[model samples]
Target: MGELKLMKGNEAVAEAAIRVGTDAYFGYPITPQSEIIEYLMAEKPHERTGMVVLQAESEVAAINMVYGAAGAGKKVMTSSSSPGISLKQEGISYMAGAELPCVLVNVVRGGPGLGTIQPSQADYFQSVKGGGHGDYKMIVLAPASVQEMYDFVETSYDLAFQYRTPVLILTDGVIGQMMEKVEVSEQKPRWTDEEIAKNTPWATFGKKKDRERNIITSLDLDSARMEQHNHHLMRKYEEIKEKEVRFEKINCEDADYLLVAYGSSARISQKAIDLCAEKGIKVGLLRPITLFPFPEKEINEMADKVKGILSVEMNAGQMVEDILLAVKGKVPVEHFGRMGGIIHSPQEVVEALEQKIIGG
Candidate 1:
């Protein structure tokens, strides 16, 4: 359907950004994700498609730049690792409250601090449960492979502008750095001023002589108005939960045991399922593609079919709690993980399932 290339996950993200008719990108370099910026700079999308790629002074500055550009109704984005993402939280909250649409890619590394440049899924709680201080949620997409890392950029932007909210492409160091064959879409021209004006009537772009000027701000000193705004946000979230929940089911039809995971964990669990099959164990995998609008309903359904659910993650049992609530105690929901940037193997996952869910 598109041009194919062997590219690293981070490079796919950068290339996809250019192809998606993106107006601008502002980001700072962090390991595991630095390739995104590097590829963009080397490619010089401005020369090819009038795309602007600027390395910001800091992650905070980059996110604010995205806010400013997105306000102008331009397709904009930024990428960073975990700690850098933390620095951008306030801006992310501002973007969310203002209802500005933009794509943010977080190639997760380790920890509460600078944990490690190696892969880790420790940011699950931060990503899905509102990392910034507010009653705000980003549409979080957990991409498992380099192809998904490439493909989700366009999907994130589509969701962002459709809902007029920020969207996140959340992956980890392994996916960001891993190389794979990806089919990239052909580059499209950037949106013209007239096109932007027509498509995004709410955008704070140059107000036409006939139309009323758009006012964009998240600040409301009036408690009543703020509460009303919160209500509106909640309504939007409910609609998204109904409409945008995405997931993948592997060998779930007749599985006796299930593995619930996402991102790299999901990929590992797929192999673990094969290992389980070889052992005459019927293990299935339920991968949540959209972490925010999680596939809770589907998981609840799976609970009725499977004997137990093993929440495989790279954190300290973060997503396990969500699975627990989804199952509603209908069956066993246990967690297996390795923190501090240590990746777990398929054998390890199989062992955890045998001991924790079945043997326990």
Candidate 2:
């Protein structure tokens, strides 16, 4: 077993990046997630592991830096909260379009515009569905625990490089700020230049005499070529959907009702499940680990078994639409949320389940 240490979720994420040999981190400071860059700056990963850590002038610049670094075939990453993430949407879209590999962490907070530093899942649509303008998809991983926060960093890098696309770690402030015991993996050495060249031939490194110069751009002037590119992207998404769906089912063996949630909401919903159990209600929890390649198969199968499903979140019902699509109206699925940075307690979630799903 790896060494266990008590750490905050944000700290765990930063340390995990170091353990995974992330080549660079370019991010702007934002509340609820600033710990990521702060830890990197304090730890001086450049001195420890030769990893570059830079605080860019703005979120826009930070993401563009990530795009540039990732284009050079490096394992790059960045972190931000809701509003800051919004500012990086254009750069994120560019990364997705160019099929650059990088990891983005959204320690989500309340928002439409500068909402709150408190936790919220309001960015579900923006994170899972295309955030910026274009027909592109990012691999989204929602970590429910501090342990997952540590573990998913490595997973995100692997998936990003495997698919040649950006991967998002969708978490919230509650998890980011909370402290928990985490077992971290062994430190990995950074990829050598030879390894990078061998693994990422498409990367825009200095062109050698043997091969043509690599071009990383989303632009396609020819209409027919653009259509072809779109088709290619769709095929990639299909492959990701087919192979990468991940979710966790808890107490679902003979459950009568189900709670659908992810990240911090999933943690709270687990408590809600226990609360419902005390009242003789067998409530199961289906927590999606991968939001983009959603666990639709598991959700659909559970929808057939459970009498009702309660989609719990910290927003005004965003992921509920995905649940609805999965269930296909086979069973009743209702959304229960507390918006504007408000977090719902376990008791409140139980009440909502009874009022919105079970009784009503």
Candidate 3:
């Protein structure tokens, strides 16, 4: 166990990056998530750990910087809000296509375009499905608390390097701005040059006499080669789905109804579960930790045991579709959401469950 400290989610994330010994961080400022870069700059990780922290002129430039650093086998990361993340989509896609390992954090805000700076889960589809063009996937982790915000940085980096793919931490403004107690882990030193050389033979860190120069590019001019690359990516995704599905099941032993949510919605839905229990409603809650390799098997099994399921979110019903697919009509599934940065109360969620699942 590490020392516990009270901190905001954004600050926890930045501090955790420092402890995790991230090689570099490149990001542009955006409201709700700006605190991340601000904290990093104030901490001056460059002085302490030789970590580079740079604020680019634009999100596009920031993500491209991440791509470059990651190609050289550096543990780099970037953070932004919804609109800024949208601008970085092209770079994210290119990194994925090139099979580069890196971390991306999206403290989501409401929007089709610059909607609001408040918290939102509206980017569910974009985060889980391919946000950018291509047959690709990012290992997406959703953090529900300040502790999780701190913890997932290391988890994201481990998974990214393990799979040789990009990883995304999909949170929202509520978690980003909210204050909570977090137990931060001890600091670890960054990889040495010898470690990098021995481990990352494919990285383009200058040609050595021992091996050919490594090239990192998404461009595959030959049709057959491109198809082969796509097939390889698909296989990797399938392997991740098989091995990395993570979720939390609460009070599911004898519940007649279930609540499904993730990230901030999951935190609120837990309160709803307690409220439902007080009213003699045995309502369980299933919180997905990994959005990309979604807890489909657990959800499907719960669908058979429960009479109904309610999907609660901060969006206009994006994740509900995945819930429906998982349930497969074995039990009725309903959606309740508040969009445009409007957060729903726990009581409100309980009422929606009563009307849509219990009463219905």
Candidate 4:
């Protein structure tokens, strides 16, 4: 363990990126997440760790910088808010098409168009199901707390390298702005240059000694080949869904109602769980750590035993759809949420649960 310290979620993510030996960072300033770029700028890791940090003129340029660095087989990352992330969707889809490994952080705010600086999980579908004009997916990790912001960054980077794909840390402004105590882990995975050379044959660096002229590209002109590429991407998604699903079960062993939530909304949902407990209405919270590869099997199993499920989210009903699919009509599934800069209070969540579980 390094040391326990109180830090904001965005700052924690910046520190984690440096500790993980990220080669480069390219991003634009955005509300709530601007602290991330500011922290890196103030720290000047280039002098200490030989990392490159550049503030691009636009989110599109920043993500393209990520694309260029990733093409060279470097650990690269970018951070932005909702509208900014929306602008970077083209680069993200291109990275997915090229099968480049990189990490992307989206500290979400209210969306649609310059919605608000307040916390919102409106980008849930965008992060999971490729928001851009393409058929692709990114390995999405949802951090409910500041600690997860630190730990999951490293995990996200590792998963990106393992799958040769992009990994997204889907966070909200609430988590980004909240100050919390976190332990920065000292232990980290070691990837030597030789190992990287052995693993990444597709990297577009000068082919030293090795005669293979590798080209890093996403364009497949042949329609049949593009169809094959789509199939390959789908297979990778299936593998990730089966192997990478992560979630936390709370008192689910004998609960009447299951509460499905993730990211900052789940933090508020905890209070609702306590309240339901006082009322003798057994409730369990299912917090999805890996939002893209959701714990569908676990949710389906819980649905069989529980009376119904209530999805509490900051968005209207993004996660609720996934929950409904998991249950697949086995039991009733309801949604309670607040959007456009408003987040539900604990009592509100409890009220939703009470109405859904008791009244219905």
- Per-candidate Cα lDDT values, in order, are 0.94, 0.95, 0.94, 0.90
- How far residue 208's Cα lies from its native spot in candidate 2, in Å, is 0.2
Which pairs of residues collide in model 3? none
lDDT of 3 at 241: 99
Model 2 lDDT per residue over 16-124, tens place: 9999999999999999999999999999999879999999999999999999999999999999999999999999999989999999999999988988889999999
Candidate 2 to truth, TM: 0.99
Give a tens-digit lDDT track for model 1, residues 1-360.
Answer: 887899999999999999989999999999889999999999989998999999999999999999999988999999999999999999999999999999999999988798888899998988888899899998999999999998899999999999999999999988888899999888878899989988788888777799999988999999999999999999999999999999999999899999999999999999999999998999889999999998999999999999999999999999999999899999989999999999999999999999999998
Position 17, candidate 3: lDDT: 96
lDDT, model 4, position 214: 77
Off by over 4 Å in 1: none
Please list the Cα RMSD from the true structure of every candidate, rounded to 1 decimal place: 0.8, 0.6, 0.7, 1.4
Give TM per candidate: 0.99, 0.99, 0.99, 0.97
- Model 2: pairs clashing at backbone N, Cα or C within 3 Å: none
Instruction: State residue 62's C-alpha deviation in candidate 3, in Å.
Output: 0.1
Model 4 spans with C-alpha error above 4 angstroms: 187-193
Candidate 1 local lDDT, residue 111? 88
